[model samples]
Target: MADIEPYENALDAIPGAHPYPRTSRYHDAEIGIHRQADGTEVRYAKRRLLPPIEDRTGDDTQSHTVRTGERPDLLGRRYFGDPGQWWQIADANPVLDPRELTDEPGREIDVPLAGHFPRSPQGDRRG
Candidate 1:
């Protein structure tokens, strides 16, 4: 899969969630598996929900003007020192799709304060 590292990182950061199939379209989704009447297994997946916009707003929040060729992971690395934390920026914005959120140039996005997110484990922060 193309650009799967961000998804893997996000999934790793979520606590106590079921492990999703890496090859599934729902690889980035939160999922539950269930057994059907005879012996069939079904997987139900939902896009992970974000916290309310109000919850992400704060005095320390900062804004970034989208520049050409910028992406969430790139922005995360630039601002937070960890590219894997892209979801933090995605969750703070209003768009349901993070790709759309970062696709345009000149768009403005709110960046949550660094303290609002969990710090990366000492060894995990890497380019």
Candidate 2:
């Protein structure tokens, strides 16, 4: 298993992005390192490409309509009882960018059923 040192570094370099799940395959991915003319090094992780939403199973019971000013994390907390599981809602929906999933009011989003998320090594919940 790969450690999260590099991923943590990459998260520190990015703004407005949360840390990758500890059990996620991308958690161990190599971040690009570039050296500036002044000899400063910058570390960054490549944009993570999510699998197609078609790959996810549909559950009519978990479907939700985008309300005004709602976000994925809020929905995750409402449906799954965990705000950190926002990615499950993001992944189950067609939008690649989570922000787009809730960007417009009245848009419908598909939320994955409970237990649809990957489990951490310690059996903790993750997104």
Candidate with top lDDT is: 1
Candidate 1 lDDT tens digits, 9-126: 6765677443543332234554567899988988776455445565444574788899899998898788777777677787677877878667999998888876563222221122
Per-prediction TM-score? 0.55, 0.50
True-structure lDDT of candidate 1: 0.65
lDDT score of residue 102 within candidate 1 = 78
Which window of ten consecutive residues has the lowest lDDT sum in model 1? 117-126
Evaluate all candidate structures by whole-model CA lDDT and list the values in order: 0.65, 0.63
TM-score of predicted structure 2: 0.50
| Residue 9, model 2, lDDT | 56
Task: Give per-model CA RMSD.
Answer: 9.2, 8.4
Candidate 2: clashing pairs of residues: none
